[model samples]
Target: MPETRSYTLDIESLDLDGQGIAHHDGKVVFVDGALTGERVVARVTRRKPSYDKAQAETILRASAQRTTPPCPHFGVCGGCAMQHLDVAAQMAVKQRALEDALAHLGKVRPDQILPAMQGPAWGYRHRARLSVRLVPKKGGVLVGFRERRSSYVADIRECRVLPPHVSALLLPLRGLVGGLSRPDRIPQIEVAVGDQATALCLRHLEPLTDADLRRLRDFGEQHRVVWWLQPKGPETAHPLDPAQVDALAYALPAYGLRMHYRPADFTQVNPFINQALIARALTLLAVRPEDRVADLFCGLGNFSLPLATQARRVVGIEGSETLVARAREDAARQGLADRTEFTKLNLFEVDAEWLRGLGYFDRMLIDPPREGAFAVAQALAALAPAERPRRVVYVSCNPATLARDAGYLHHVGGWVLKAAGAVNMFPHTAHVESIAVFEPSATAA
Candidate 1:
């Protein structure tokens, strides 16, 4: 049987995932619902040879940073982890986590840390995937985030992270799904909100009856939300009522750019931080009218189009042919086609020869996924001196990978780690979004 004993621990610090770190009986204990510098009585829920996991049974002493979570389902819902921590404190912790990842994993440091990018702490998540389950035993269908550290669906009435209008649909959604003919077959719902409209893409494992479709349309009309249905995969999603809503899009007024994306496409969850990040990246790159810039892993020309506004020419390379086509269309519509060119290429396998084929660029911007851009960095490092970009800006969703790539660029590629900082794109969550600037070393230049 698992250990069921309770122990008192003095919380020392927080781990990368916001779990409180404590030492108990010569072993490391990770206690949930505990804050740093607090004394808590915790019960061991799970044990391992290296570390143990526990739940705080009682808080003997609380930290000043602790606050009553505005969401009643904070502890039970897996959507957020650090809601109990003060908003400013949450940003500070994320910044520290980024610095720690860079130091320990990458063996490098930035010359300066930029200010943390922050926005409204609540009602900021423009996109989310909510789980749906039919629990007839307890009540009816449950629609929300999963239970913390468990596979079960959380019983939540509302979600504060979603926009006010979207949050108001939670209970209504539960009722709508519960009354469906195949309530148990509906597995999940994808929520995407744009400045103009809100959409719900329902993922159903079974075919919906005519009656079910009518009910879904009714719910959409009642709640002023567009209904999309996915019979199997993301590609199968389409509008239930074709004439109801326009294509989803967001605007970056600073750059005079509008980005239209499909519901399943990967876009930033927080529009506020996304705009800030783009502005900061462009400023760091220092693009000039005479400069030729390259945007690697550029999805739908998010950065390429904006760069075109200032650069002599901008070349965007991405892996998805569909996204490349969309980007090309968007650039033309925005009257930027003359200065912008997009190509489809898998960047993960990019090498020195591939880099040279792209020709010389004065500046470059890389916004890679969680795996980071190690291959891109290595290729850039191997480029001929005359062909290498003078400056590069990297946007990352994972700090560990960012740090590793930064170390390679700074140490092996002879690049200077000029500045780096964290972006609070996901408030109350452990996910860290950061950006960094790099320049060629004096000798290399």
Candidate 2:
């Protein structure tokens, strides 16, 4: 067993995970529930060769930026990490973390730090995969997020980050699952909310009985929420009552577009922030009526369809055939079939030859997953001066990967890191969503 000891330390800074960083006897210590510039008594929870992990036992001195977390389940639930920190301070911390990652990991910095994107901190999460556990010892079925650093399900009555209607379903969900025939077989619930509808995709390990379907329908009717059953995988999900429920969709009022997505399809977790992000990205790309833009890793054409509104032509490329088909269908529905086109390709394996075949683009929009776009950067770097896009806007969820790719664009591709900023998509959480603009150095001349 690890030895436990208490130490009063002054928090010097915060780590990327929102934990307070302090030094005790020359060893770095990470303390949870502690804020920077605060003095706190912490109990060591774990020990390592170079650093220690602790939980704040008592706050002797508090920082002005610290605030009382509104969520009752703030500490126990693993969903959010920085609730105790003031909202403004939370944004500042994330911005600093992004800059630190860029400087230290990528050896590059942007010319200007764009103002951080802000949105409603609470009730912003529109997508979440809630864990469902039937623990008899912990009182019947438990529904919500998992316990912090534990495998046990958190016994949360409600969540502040989720939509109000969805948050109100926690207790009811627990009861619904508890009364089911095979409560233990139900492993998880995927929540997806759009402007018009809310969907709950229940993942059941074993086959659900006919009675189970009836119960789900009854629950959906009571809550006025759509129900989807996932017996095997995401591809197996289907609506309980397709005839009664409308397809899940969210409108981008600014772009005059509405995006349709399945419950299992990937969409931004925060709709409001997504709207602001799309606007900012489009502005940074500076699309003109005659401009032709390429959107790489364009899942469901979230950016492509919007770009088509301003740009003369937009080509969206994705690795998933399903997403490409959906993008094309959405484009056609939006009467943008003439201005937009989508293709399915493995972007991770993209080469200069493949890129050249796609034709010329004045600007490029890349919203890659956490792995980043190393291949895309390499392909752009290999392109001749005449064929390369003049400007590129990168939307990233991981700052480290974004910085690395930014470095490649700057050092290897001879591009300039014009500007970058953080978008607080998942507020009160450590997940950083950011955007960066890169242009050829020659453009400055």
Candidate 3:
């Protein structure tokens, strides 16, 4: 139990969640809406044996990095966490957090820290899942992200992270949904924006009436957006009229590539940063024309296709059959199928033997989910020096997991941490994306 009374505390640092950390009576306290080096009066919201959670009520002293949030629904909406902090400060904090994780958790340090990759601070999100709820007391319906620290949907007319056109559709979408046969039945709307068109996938619990279908068509026509209906799982989602929809795709002009993907398929949320990341990853890989490369956990061949353009042969391994099939199609469309191979395999279940059975790779690219490719790291560490890839470039969405795997690679596998840096994939949020390069140590080789 926590005391209802407020207490004055000094914020020492910012945690990974962007909450300020302080010490009170020998217990750690996490204070929301506080910045590092700020003294604030906070009231405890929840308590645990080792720590307490609080919300800052009054700022006795404000930090230089603190700024007024641009979004009106900043605190209530869970979409953006560090909007109150200056954009430059946000990137600096993320970089520091990455270095700290590498040093403290991994007990390894990069020989060189690459410059933090950055891009636009607003209207950069290309993919998002908006929540929907019907509340008669407050309003007819609410459509936006979930509230901070809550499951309830936040009432927002516009989103700062979404594109200007999509943000403008928020109110229209609310009306569009409220007029539906069962507004409450539609629990979520997934947004996917491509270079040419935008898509809105409506997840309904029950079958929609002809009137509801007509409303969707009218909205789509007026807004110039596609409507996808999902009565059940994500796979069930299909465009109401595929003929009217433009093929959802993004272009990598540098590689002369245009990658197509379904609305439900996994793609980077930030297209600007995705392009920069791919260029950086390829540079770090130093792919030679004769090199045989392997892309682990490749989704939709984002990296494999690009690598295929440079490498003699590129092998992509993924866990999902659907993603593998799509990757193959994309490779064929890009005219890289002859040089690229797509395989469906659970990388998480692989070991040294399984990895060795696949033969040798000159270099490898790893773009895994937040779980951080621990099993793959273990397999690489278990492999003989001759069997291991000569070089590896890892792209991660989680700093902590990247550090853990970096530790295993450096400490146990005799790999050198050549370079690592943070990527600002999601601006104004606590999320930290990073890239690292590793090579076998001279002694081990």
Candidate 4:
């Protein structure tokens, strides 16, 4: 139990949740956006005997790491939190955040901490889902991210993290939506990037008129972007017409491979970071010429195709039958079908015995959803020492779940945490994309 009373406190540390944790009068205090080495007076927002939350309204002295934010809607827009902090400082804090989480929650630490991975701070986000609103009381349509911790959309015109073209389209999108018959009915706008062009998917609640269709088509031609309209479910999305303009695709230069994906599919938003992450994960996996590798939750064969170049065979498992068939087609197109295998399985609820009957492999790499591949990881951990893969490379988007799963493998599976590090996959934001390597204890030393 903690002391219950109103007391002014100073922030000591920043948690991974983007909140600063400190102590006052023997009670834990969490202050929003208050960094270390800075003194601030905050009011208690919530009180539990053990811990309390506070809101910092003023900063008497700001940290040197803090800087002027470019976006006017910095605090109001929920898209990013650390934009005010210097880039290097932000990465350092994130590194500490991961370290703290592991030490405090997992009761363990990796033997080695890999250098944190950093990338372009601005114009790095290649993917985003923007929200739309028509607030009659306020004005016309609101075309941007939702307000910080609120359902109301932020009244924004430019985003520093988005690519220039995407940023430039916001104001125009607002005007265009204002022109729509039911602008408020339009809920989402999904953006995806392919190798050659950018694509936008408009999710509307009602059918569009011929006039509305003409405007969207005209906008597509003028901006040189592909326009897709989603009237119902995800499967219902399609191009405005027969000719697909500005098809988004990305290239993997190391393998001379080019792959195409729809905007809604899972692809790394930062090309540079994605490539670097793939290279790092492969190095950790250490694929051998004769080694067979398993890539669980592999989407569109991003890691599978790259693994084929080094491994004797690469097996990719995904939950979507559509994605599985598409991966198979991609493997065939690349003429790597002989080296790559595709399967559809619910990674979250896997059949351990059924997977064991399939044979074995030397290495495994997984890039699962935000859920963190709990079942798949647990099953892999349960395999006999002789049957289990020797090494694993995990790329994760959520820190808490990744740490939780990491604990299970290290504590229960007789494995050693070799190395864990952070990647600036989503800069200026609270999202931390990280990769970790685990190895058999005997080989770890």
How many clashes does each candidate structure show, in the order listed?
0, 0, 0, 5
C-alpha TM-score for every candidate? 0.97, 0.98, 0.97, 0.93
lDDT string, candidate 3, 322-348, tens digits? 889989998988799999999999888
lDDT of each: 0.90, 0.92, 0.92, 0.83
Model 4 lDDT, residue 24, Cα:
80
Give me the overall lDDT of model 4. Answer: 0.83
Look at candidate 2 and tell me the lDDT of residue 7: 86
lDDT of 3: 0.92
Name the Cα RMSD for model 1: 1.5
Write model 4 residue lDDT over 1-445, tens digit each, in one string: 3223344566777765567778987878888767776677777767876888887767766788878888887888999888777888888877777777677776669899999998799998899999998888877888889997889899998999899899999999988888977787899899886768888899999999888888888888898888889999887788786477326578889887776677666788898899889889998898899999999999989899989988999999999886787678778887889999999988888856866977998999989988888887678778777887889998998877788888878777667888999998888887888888888666321
Query: Worst 10-residue stretch by lDDT in candidate 2?
Result: 238-247
State the lDDT of candidate 2 residue by residue for 296-356, as single tens digits: 9999999999999999999999999888988998999999999998989999998899999
True lDDT of residue 170, candidate 1: 90
Ten contiguous residues with the weakest lDDT in model 4: 1-10
Q: Model 1 segments beyond 4 Å from truth?
A: none
On the 0 to 100 scale, the lDDT of residue 23 in model 3 is 97
- Return the lDDT, model 2, position 196: 89
Q: Clashes in candidate 3: how many?
A: 0
Q: Candidate 1's residue-wise lDDT over 240-347, tens digit each?
A: 988753468899899888887777777789998888888999999999999999999899988898899999999999988878987998899899999999999989
| Candidate 2: clashing pairs of residues | none
All models, RMSD in angstroms:
1.5, 1.5, 1.4, 2.9
> Where is model 4 more than 4 Å wrong at Cα?
1-8, 43-53, 443-445
After TM-score superposition, what is the CA distance of residue 263 in candidate 4 from its true location, in Å?
Answer: 1.5
